[model samples]
Target chain A: MTELTRIIELFQLPFMQRALLGGILTGLMGGMLGSFTILRQLSFFSDALGHSALLGISIGLLIGINPSVVLLPFAVCFALGVTYLLERTRLWTDALLNIIYSSSLAIAVIVLSFVGQYKGGLNNLLFGDILAVRELDLVFSGLLLIACTVFIGLTLRTQMLLTLHEPLAIARGVSVSAQRTAFIVLLSLVVGISIKAIGVLLVSAFVVIPACAARLLSRTFTNYVVLSAGLGALSAVAGMLISAAFNLPSGPSIVATQLVIFLTTMALPQLRALGHG
Target chain B: MREIVLSVEQLTVYRETYAAVQDVSFSLESGIDTAIVGPNGAGKSTLVQAILGILPRQSGDVFILGQPLSCRGSLAPAIRQQIAYLPQNFLFDRRIPMTVEELVGLGWDKLGFQLPWKDHRKRRHAIREALVRVDAAHLMHKMISGLSGGETKRVLLAYCLVRPRRLLILDEAPAGLDVRGESEFYQLLYQLKREQGWAILQISHDLDMVRRHCDRVICLNRTLLCQGTPEVALSSDNLSAAYGSEFVRYRHRH
Candidate 1:
């Protein structure tokens, strides 16, 4: 098939449309929140949350509930627990996250061992099969994207301040701890929601790399977020197209595309310097 | 009317049963410059945090501008709005992505909502004026990441001055300063005290400087051993009480 014919064929499928929409929404939310994750050094927290999604789903399956339905609250409460531990204890953030990641992985493995019939569904969740995207998933992803944008708009500046100096933020009359908790909760929501599209194994790749790439390209914080979200959305949708044509896994395919974007962005600075010289 | 800008009764803090500060009580009158002088780990910073409602007080009551603090994590913004705090700049990560202008503006309680564009001239004038007073005007546009230890403190000092609060708390400020820098810092504080009539609370180890500049001295070590005029509070006997048996006997020239 020629390029035009292939493009026409790809857009004709309803599942393809849903998958592309879900991927785009997931990418946008992941990108925007990922900027904060990288800036505040919460990549480990996000990664831990991503991994814990499997445990949440597995537990849901064990209790005979739809995993997707239970994933949101489970992820949020888990993130809050992580946040509390990070605050109440003197343990380093990464170390705490590592403990959560490993224990969550173990729990997931243990739970999956007993889940006989729902194994295929769990596999689809563990490694996202975006080709099976439903209309409900598209709706949920769209709502999350809107929610994430509104949240970022409302709390972005204060969040930046809180991230910079918690003590100072407190002294400034900002509810430092509350804002911190709210931030981790938002990260949890993004991580939890994106798990269905990006998968447990590589969700953080979407949330972290895009922001880092944007950081190298951005001179201002505003530009950092804008570029991050834009790059993320672009990669997510484009990678879904590639996945469709080549029968690749949507999650890893999108992650690989972001890596390529980051590399290209990293090289742009050098290319510009060379041009100047 | 009560002139006390801040009052603390039996303020105590503990770290896993180790009392970092215990039964500390004092009150500050408006426009009085009080110095809290102690050795390292003497709970000076703890007391400052308690007053600011930053630390969880194990036991105590704190009143700021006649409003009692409930030790419920942190006080409301309206309460903190009446105060300007210059905490230990050494604790802040210099790499935080902020400019001096942005940081100094953050001192205002309402600046969080206002665009810097709308408040730029008024805020800039105030920030620059404060920066000019502290001799940090050249760093107005500089990223916080690039500042030296002394420069960061100066910038923080400007932040404290940007808004005219009724009370000012300086905790271990000017830590990386030389004697000359220390002299300049106190002089500026003294000037601000005279001009603004805001109660000034200084947490430091510079006894001589406090003696020369502050109206009162609080010699603290987990508890309030003594609080009075610098001449009396800095006395050897009171110094022994505050610093414990191993306290050094610095010769008082006066």
Candidate 2:
């Protein structure tokens, strides 16, 4: 068969289409939320939340439930708890993040060990099988993307700028607490949904590296969002194409493509200025 | 006489167990430009924070346009809309991707209101006008992270002026500016006061600037030392009390 015919046949299966749609939606949301994630210096928080998803996924597998549903509430609670503890306590935010990150990974590994008989299910989650995506996952991811897009677009001016310079925003009457809560919740939702496409291990990179690369290449804030989304979408599509062609894992390929983009952008003379290089 | 826009009676601000601002009482009349002058560590910032409801007031009554200040609820959106504040220091992540225009637009974003009006032309005009007023129109498209200290101050000043608030509170607004920039900034404030009748409360350490520009002066040294026109309130004794021995040296130099 010709290359075009092979690709067409690959997508003719319902699962491939679902995975592609889900990846695109997740990438778009990741790009948008990544802008604020970088702006607010909450990259560590994203990492912590991503790792915490494993615990939720483990529980889902143990109970024989839809992993996404279990993971969403778990991620939201983890995000909110981290935010509250950081704000209300005297402990340094970075230290708290490290604790959450390491502990969650340990718990997930221990729980997964107990359920060793479900190795196949755990492996599916770890290295997301995009070709195995269900229709429900596609619908949920699509709605999430739409909701997150509208929310981010509506509050784009206030939320992004406030995250950049909070005191200045506060002086101009932006409610810092309210805006922060909304942003963290939005991020958690994005992380929860994207876990299936990028897997919990690589999802935070999907949210961070693309935005960081976009920031280097773009001059303005709006451009950053658009460019980040474009880069993320490109990486997801390219990764899926390469993975299908080589019969390799899609999740790692997508993440690897993102890293390549990040490195390439970093090496460009004009973009290099963005990193203090 | 213009009405009192702000009244503080028996105001005291404590940082932990120590009293930072003690028994400070002052009233700012509308259309008047008042300067809060004191040495560093003399609680000028603490006093302003207390009035803005950012810092807790240990014991005091703060009335904004005849209404008691409330911190429990979000500052009344209307009141907040009508008030502008310029903080002393503003820092943002350098990697943050944003422009001066986007930052200034944040001034118009209030709670419970979806900004349905996306009139880019009108918003840009307003942003331009604010930038031009602060002599920062050229920097409107510049990345906030790339601007110099003085340029950043001017941009932030433009951000504050995007909306015409009844009262403008500037904490060290001219701290990092050059002599010409500082002069032009104060001149802009004076012109705004003349044309718009906006009340200005400047927290500054530049006594000379305060003498030249302020309609009234409030000297603080953990308490209200004096309040009135600069000539009457800035007497040598009051200055001495506020700055200890520095007043004598300042007088000699002047």
Candidate 3:
């Protein structure tokens, strides 16, 4: 078969199509939420949430249930828990984040150890076997993407800006607490769905690297979101191509592509003046 | 007498076990410019935060335009829509990608009723008008992270002005501005007060500007020390009570 035909054949399989759809949806949500994440200096928090999802997913597998369903509530609970700890506790936020990040990973490893591995078991969530993604995963991710987009687009002007400067937002009559809670829930949802494509270990890279690259190129916050989404989509496509050609793992290849984009943007002099390097 | 726009009755704010502000009572008339002056750590910011519903109130009631301020429910947003606040510290991450125009446009985001004029052009026009009012129109397209301290303060003030809120509360709004910038800012404040009939409550350390610009002053040192015209409130006893003997002497020297 020719290259195009082979590529078509790869996607013609139900699993490959599911993986592609999942990646695209995750990219859109990541790009949308990632702008606020980077602006609020919560990149570490995103990573923490991603790792926390692993523990949730592993626990789901241990109970013989669908991992995604189990993982959503677990991730949201963890996200709210972290938010409360950061707001109420005396500990510095970064220190608290690091503790949660490592502990979640450790818990996942312990849980996975108890659940004896079958062939391509945890690897599906780690490296992401694009050839094995189910149709249900595709449908769920699409719905999530649409919901996130509508909510974000509706409150884009007020709520997103609130994360940038909360006190100001409060002063202007924006529901500071409500906006924050909604944002955290949305972030949790994004983290929960993204684990299937980028995996728990590398999901943060997908959210952060594209936004960081776009930050260097854009002048306004609106432009930054658009550029980040564009970059993220571009990286997903490129990574898929590279993975197909070299038979590399899809998740790592995607992350590697994003890093390359980040580095290139960092080196550009025009972007350096914008202080994104 | 004009109607009271803001009334604080037995207002108290506590930080953990310690009482930061205690039984502070004041009634600010509509269209009046009131200055809040006190030494650092005297709880000026705490009082402001309490009034804005950001801090938990230990006791007492805050009424804005005859409505009791509720910390929860839609009342908070309703009260907030009528008031604009400028925080003591205005810090943004240098990595954030936003321009002056976008920042100012955020002021209209809280108009939650979905007015017919939600179009981008209308929003842009409102932002541009606000910037021009503060003499920051030229910097509309400038990146926020690149602006100087004085410029940033101006932009923030512009942000506050974009919405036609009845009460404008500013905490050290001109703290870091140079003499000219400070003078120009207060001039703009005077214009806003006279032309738009805005009621302004500001916390300021600059005694001269307080004396020259504000109609009344409220001195605080954990409790209400004095409230009246600048000369009356800045009396030696009140100054000493709020700022200690060192500030009293410093004021006399100047």
Candidate 4:
């Protein structure tokens, strides 16, 4: 009946705990990798992978396999395929990405027609259900967080070298092509795993939003990465709590919180400039 | 024997079945600034790229530090690290989120190895030194995308110089610079070349600058036309030979 009692009741539920933990982990991972996603303009690629996960799911259902398990490798392959196309073809980039993700979604729909539709099985993945978060899902997200953090830490300098100037990086003896492949695989894994919690529609927002927000405030590279991850975690926890309080869906709630953060952080500097003037 | 930093022998590269570069060969001696001068589409950059093992050589071989370039396997990185390069028309994303300091740090820590506290500090010190040498110390905190054309060139030069190098390959390293910035870039390059005894190999269209600065010049028009001292290479006769009727002395700035 009371607000405090209602809040206590929410925390008392095990599923709520799992959702909170999973959301926080996924958010942090997304934020960390999102820095590179934004810088490398791989947001579109991540989005495509997100959609491609649905195609994987459709194929899994058709073959009587678990969709969640199939999503990872399928997404990785899909990203690699895109990378290969980019390297080999002179097609305009916008047309290239548009063709890839759209074809993926279209294939998914056709497969869904034969294997049955989004009634129950597909609905869960499309928009996500935070209330259905399980202990294993939490563990998977936690592992992804650790994996992303370690990869970013280890490859930070090398990836930056490759990204800043590939020819120069090559001259400096960096295997930029190899490094690029590794980065794409990691991005695919993140996008694949993220689909269960944030869904295809909102997965990229978790990535791009926190990084865009952090970009406004960070003055250095290390600070930018740290801040993005921190913002992501905060947005996750805060958004989860807000969603619980208001009985709203968790994914969009979290994205709204991040958008607000980006706007506020972006405006603060201009506001300070106004004060100075 | 005089120290040979790089030797390219009969290198040919094809782009879409047409020879972008054909039977190009030249050797760079240590402490000498060598310029490869040519007209547009002459494949000067292509030659430099092939030498660094960035592009496949259709034929012939490149020996850097007296070892042949394999362009693959474990040896490539080590060999590449020995040669510092600045690419002409470096494909830069204008919205790339990085500062001059961080980007330069990328060049300093090329292998992406996380160092201990002392080594990390030393790396930072080396980065600062490179920036200072290139006269870009003041622009260290600026966002890379926000820099002016000349400043970007200086920062890129600093980035290339962050690590130890035996051979320095520059592809139009001074493209966007003004008169003063261009001269300053050359001065900084020559000062370091003299101090470190580096083999300076560069691609340029500026015959006047090449004549003033380079010890040796290789004139190219899709292939080696002449390789000699700049006086001999950039003479009216030699320029006409490489550039054909397109070559005009008045076109070159003093």
Candidate 5:
């Protein structure tokens, strides 16, 4: 079979099909929420949440529960704690996120050392094994996607206003605190679900890269959001196909694909300018 | 008779441990334009933030249209919604792709948890009317990120005008504009105040503008130093007390 046909054949397998579905769902969720994350300058916060997932996974391994299940609540609480500190303590955002990111990572490493036969399991989570994605994982991703979609769809305008100018949004009575907390909660959930398909190391790339690409190409906010979702899904599928074709690691391949898209977007304006010149 | 629209009583706000504004009290009535004047660090912005409940006040009571908007450290949202505020700086990420029309639409009076089922035509008309009122109708379709400083101010003013407000508070709304631009902006604001009977409260540094357009002035230097008609409040003695030796040089320069 030709290379393209061979890649298609790989995707025809049931396990590959599951992996593709999980990736697409994760991509959609990440892309939609990532726009807000990027706009609110919460990219570092999202990265910290992703890194902190390792602690959740390590704890689950210690307790003999599925890491994925444990990660959901762990991430939610982590995000809420960070949000509370940010609101109450008034520390600079980067300072707090950096402290959380580094500390969580250190604790996770120490915990992982205690986990017997941890090498294989840790590698799978850090780099991801899309072929190992189970049906239950896909279901969780689907439900989370729906929850995010409904919440974002219902509050798009108000969320947009808040993202653009928070003080004005507050003055206009947009329930800024409640909406922000809801957003952070949804983001943590997305990070938890996404860590399975994208891996802890590359998950933020999955979340932020497509949105950055979309911003480079979009002319309006609505266009930016829709394009972000589109680019995310497109990158995930393309990355999976590349992974299958090259027999490469799925998570890093997906992130690499997203970077390629971002670079292409960054270069488009220049290319157009060159053409005009 | 014009009713009192905003009342701030014994308002005290602190930054860290020091009182930034102390025992400041003022009331604004409909059809009267009021200005707050003070030197730098006199708690002009802090007073506004405290009254708007953006900042936690040490002790204060802020009422709008007879309803308590804030008491001590707590703010009532329903009461605060009645007042429109134009902050000194309209801060946002420049890369955001919002349009002037979209920005103004965010100020629509009916913004709530319900789906936006309001009449689209009426909403569009209101947005257009607000932009036109600010001489920014031509900018409705333009991206907010691409707007110039003056255009941004006009668009923000249009945002405040999109909804009915019991009181309008502007925090140095004309700070960066040229002398002509400042005069014209104040003129437009005065016209809006006259037409809508808006209780206008603004923070300003231009003594000339305060003397010309404001019905009353409140001078501050950590505490209320003066509050009266511009003639009394902007008197040399009161100016000296609020601004210290700096005002004498500033007054002589003008």
Candidate 6:
């Protein structure tokens, strides 16, 4: 079969429908929140949260509960814990984040080792299997996407002001700490939902790569946000199609697509200059 | 009687364990422009930040327009709406993609949960009016990251002027400007203060500008050393005391 034929045939299946819908929703959330993540210098935080979420999944599997449900609370705790430590103590921020990132990932590996019944499950968690996207996962991710959209839409102006300059935001009577906590919480939620389809290792690429591309191409803040979101969705869908065609892993495929888009954006301005020359 | 716009009593602000500002007491009345004149590391910026409730006070009370401001939490929205602040060389990411219009639009006093559809025209007009006053009308659509230092300062000044305010606080706001730019900025500030009847409190190192423009000056070096008319408070003894014994007043010859 041709690559396009394979992609179209795959989408005709129920599982592919679920995977595509989940990927698109996850992509939209990641893109929207990624703008704030990159601007606030929390790109690493998303990666850390992704790694930490593996512990929650391990715990969930051990306890015979849904990993997706457990990931919500687990991600929230990790995000809040980091926020609290950063605020209360004067530790170097990157050091603190790295400490948490390395330790949690190590602990998650140990915990996953304890789950001996599910052979070869580690590979699935490390590299996602979008074909395994369940109806429950879709529903959970859909609800999360809606919540994220409404929250971001309503608070975009206030969030933009705060993200631009926090002290100025504080002076303007924005509850900076409160807003920060809320933003990090929402970011964690997005990361948690995405981990199932994008996997722990590759999830943050969905958040950061699209935003990096959008930042290079966009002239205005609004344009940057919109473009980031659009690029994320585009990457997710196109990556899924490419994965179907080549029988490749979905997470890496999506990330590879995003990298191509980012490189294109980077070269566009230089290409334009060359054209003018 | 002129209303007291800002009142700070026994305000002590600590940076880590050491007090950056200790026992700073002051008040600003309507229509009076006050300058907080101090040398480097004199806690002048800390005093303003503490008063604005952006920093935690060690032990103190701040009252703005008779409303008590807590030292721990954020300022009340109502009180914040009545005041304009230009932070000291405000730190932020220079590569942000925000426009001057978006930055100034957020400065409107009535920004809350209200829909943007209502009073959209009014918000646009206010932003443009403030930008025009700052002589940055042409930069309304320009990216904030792309602006020069002087242009950024002007844009931020327009942010302060985007709404009606009874009190204005500036923290070394003209630090990066040239002499001509600084002079023009102070001229604009003077006109705005008079026309709006604003109670102004500014932290400045420019003794000449403070001496010429300020109605009162507060000399500070971690604490309030002296305060009075610039002629009295800026005396040789006060300057020596606040700025240390090595201080020498330089007078420029025209």
Ranking by lDDT: 6, 5, 4, 3, 2, 1
lDDT of 3 by residue, B118-210 (tens): 687978888999999888999999999899988887788788778777888899987777899888878777887787778888899988888
Model 4, C-alpha of A85: deviation from truth (Å): 2.1
lDDT of 6: 0.86
Q: Model 4 chain B, poorest ten-residue lDDT window? A: B110-119
TM-score of chain A of 5: 0.96
Cα lDDT of all candidates, in order?
0.79, 0.80, 0.81, 0.82, 0.84, 0.86
Question: Which tens-of-lDDT digit does each residue in A1-277 have in candidate 2?
Answer: 6876787798777777777777777778888888778877888888889888998888877778867779889988888999999998888888988888788888888887877777556666666666666788778878888887778777777776577766656655567788888889889988987887677778898799889889888888878888888888888888887777777788888888888999888889766576676
Tens digit of per-residue lDDT, candidate 3, span A138-192:
7777788788777777777775467677777665556776777888888888887
Alpha carbon lDDT at A241, candidate 3: 71
lDDT of 1 by residue, A1-277 (tens): 6866786697788987888888888888888988888878888788888888889998988999988888899889999888888888898889888998899989888998898767556567777777777898788778878777877776666766666677777766677777677778878887887787767888899899899888777645566788889889999977887776776777888999999999989899799999999
Clashes (candidate 3): 0
iRMS per model, in Å, is 3.3, 2.5, 3.0, 2.6, 2.6, 2.0
Q: Comparing 1 and 3 by DockQ, which wins?
A: 3
Q: What tens digits encode model 4's per-residue C-alpha lDDT throughout B96-167? A: 668998888877774755632337887889889999988889988988878887788788778778888888
Question: DockQ of each candidate's interface versus the true one?
Answer: 0.33, 0.54, 0.56, 0.54, 0.45, 0.57
Most lDDT-accurate candidate: 6
What candidate 4 gets wrong by more than 4 Å, as runs, is A117-121, A274-277, B72-76, B112-118, B245-254
Q: Candidate 6's error at B219, in angstroms?
A: 1.7
C-alpha displacement of A15 in model 5, angstroms? 2.4
Segments in model 1 whose C-alpha atoms lie over 4 Å from true places: A88-90, A117-123, A241-247, B109-138, B244-254
Instruction: List ranges where model 3 is wrong by over 4 Å.
Output: A270-277, B72-78, B111-117
Among all candidates shown, the one with the greatest TM-score: 6
List the pairs of residues colliding in candidate 5: none
Model 3 chain A: worst 10 consecutive residues (lDDT sum): A125-134
The sequence of per-residue lDDT tens digits that candidate 1 reaches over residues B1-254 is: 53998998988898667898999889999988889988788888988887787888899899888888876755555777878877775465443456776777666435244333465578668877888878888888887777876677777777777777889988877777888777776677777678878898989777767878889999887777888999899888888777764554445433
Candidate 6: residue B202 lDDT (0-100): 95
Summarize candidate 6's per-residue lDDT along A6-62 as a digit string, tens digits.
778879999999988888888888999998899989999999888888888888888
